[model samples]
Target: MNLLFLGDVVGRAGRDAVLAHLPELRRRLATDFVVVNGENAAGGFGITEKIARDFFDAGVDCITTGNHVWDQKELVGAIDRETRILRPLNFPEGTPGRGAAVFQAPRGRRVLVANVMGRLFMDPLDDPFAAVGHVLRQVRLGAGAGAGNGVDAVIVDVHAEATSEKMAMGHFCDGRASLVVGTHSHVPTADLQILPGGTAYQSDAGMCGDYDSVIGMKKEVSIARFVRKLPTERMTPAENEATVCGVFVRTDDRTGLGVRAEPVRIGGRLAPHLPEA
Candidate 1:
């Protein structure tokens, strides 16, 4: 099955880019499932119910979030009701909304989607590795515990700031997951490769927002803070055209392992990478 994982969506531009192209992109790539990180989708801080609905309407299978998942106060209640949306699993216990779930693919396939946040340089929540390992144990590839015949694939989105932590998670889930990719840094890394264990791994998947600014924020304000060594005006997302960026991976049906994976960037300032028709 072909699965697409999109990085953080910054603002209106990011949402527009996905709505305009994701449907067609899914068709061209023959994607069976798609996961989009939407923590920053609402004005660069937290996702709202309306925005989450927009993504679901746009063919996104599930939405994952990180540290900013609670930026929108109203989202707390909405996320609880929406099974398609997810917050970081390592968030404190009793947190609203789920961090992992098993979803159905169009082709009668069961797919597991899990999201976790890293601690190094991030909020110290539950141990990500432990949380993820626990989830991994709840189900296994080709052998679902009464959920179905078996899980056809697993997608793990590691929202993290440090590359080392992200890489560690990838190695930790090497043979157990179909794809392990990182988000939160908003810069796409070029080290897309199928690991020796058959899992697709990428350090960072980049953002689905304007790349012309400082990681999708207004450049001038971001630069001022760095130069002045003090807080400036509140950061807002860049409004220019956004480039939807992420990774595309195809996994084997029998082994539930990744066979091909690569970075995907379209529109805006960056050079594009799309599957050939």
Candidate 2:
């Protein structure tokens, strides 16, 4: 099955780009399932119920988030009502919303999607390795595990800042997950490759927003912060034409392991690299 996992969507540009391209992208890619990180979809902070609903309406099957998941105060109440949106599994116990969930694809395949946050250079939450292991133990992949009960595929979204931390998680879940990709940073990495264990790995999927600015924020404001070393103004999402950045993986039906992993960067300032026709 073909699975498309989009990176963090930042503010209006990202959301708009997803809404404009996602429906067509899904059809053209023949995607069975889609997961988008909507953490920074709101004004470069957090996602809101309206924005999430927009994504769902646009063909996104699941939404994952990171530290910015709680930026929108309204989500604290609304997240519980929504099952498609996932917070970091390593989040403190009893946190609103879920960290992992299983959804039946349109083609009758069961997919297990899990989100975990890394501790290095991030909020030191629960052990991500343990948290992910627990979920994998629960959701066994392939028909041999079971008939209708087995999870057909597993996709792990490791939202983090450190590349080594993300790579470690990918190997940790190697042979266990169909694909393991990172998010958080707004720069897409070029290390898309299938591991020896059959899992697909990418250091980062980047942000689904304009790449002309500094990590999706206004360029001038972000530069001032670093150059002047002083708080100038609140960061806002770049309003230029945005790009849809992500990793596309096609997994084997029997083993649920990725056979092909491709980087998808379309529109905006980034060079266009859509899936091959």
Candidate 3:
């Protein structure tokens, strides 16, 4: 099974790039499932239902989010209806939407995708490791395990600011998940490898937006805030062409572990790369 996980989508540029290239990517990569982080899709804040629907129409199977998941107040109520959109699993009980869900893929295969937020330097939510472990225990991965019983693959999105926290989560789910990738930093890391336990791990998948600016925001505004040590204009997404960043993992059907992993960067300022199908 081939799984593609895209990093945080910034504003218009990022969204447009994904919509334009995703269809071709699906064909070229022969992807069975695709998950994109849409937290920052709405003017660099939260995702709107319309935007989420746009992604789905563009062939995205699922959408994951991070700290900015609730930036759009309407999502607090609408998320419950859209099972494909996932927020952090560590959110307190009674949280509007789910943190994890099992989605059906081609050939009657099941794929479990979980979105969890790291507490370090993030919101004080439930323990992400424990939250993820609970779900993994409930849904074991294997082939021919009966309907709603076992999944063919597992993908975890660890949205965090600290690289250490993200790396810890990858190691924690080493053998259990097919791929564990990080988001929120907006800068793609060079380390992309399969762990000893068979899971594909990347410290950060980076943002699917223009890299010429400061983490997708306008360079001048971001620099002013940091240099002056005072509040400036609100940060907005860069309007230039965006580079879609993500990770692609091909998992073994029998064991549900990753057999190959590669980083994906297309368009905008970053060099382009697409894994061989």
Output candidate 2 Cα RMSD.
1.2
- The C-alpha stretches of model 1 lying farther than 4 A from their native spots are 144-149
Worst 10 residues of 2 by lDDT: 140-149
Model 2 Cα shift for residue 274 (angstroms): 1.4
Per-residue alpha-carbon lDDT of model 1 for 65-91, expressed as tens digits? 999999999988888889999999888
For residue 144, give model 1's deviation from the true position in Å. Answer: 7.6
RMSD (CA, angstroms), candidate 3: 0.9
Q: How would you encode candidate 2's per-residue C-alpha lDDT over 1-277 as one tens digit per residue?
A: 8999999999899999999999889988999999999999999999999999999999999999999999899999999999999999999899999999989896678999999999998888999999999999886787633465588889999999899999999999999999999999889998999999999999999999988899999999999999999979888999999999999999888999999999998889889888963
- For lDDT, candidate 1 versus 3, the one ahead is 3
Highest lDDT: give the candidate number: 3
Task: Report the C-alpha displacement of residue 101, candidate 1, in angstroms.
Answer: 0.4
Candidate 2: lDDT over CA atoms? 0.92
Clashing pairs in 1: none
- Runs of candidate 3 exceeding 4 Å displacement: 145-148
Top TM-score prediction, candidate number:
3
- Model 2 steric clash pairs: none
Worst 10 residues of 1 by lDDT: 141-150
Give the TM-score (vs. native) of candidate 1. Answer: 0.97
Candidate 3's residue-wise lDDT over 156-270, tens digit each? 9999989999999999999999999999999999999999999999999999998889999999999999899998989999999999999999999889999999999999999
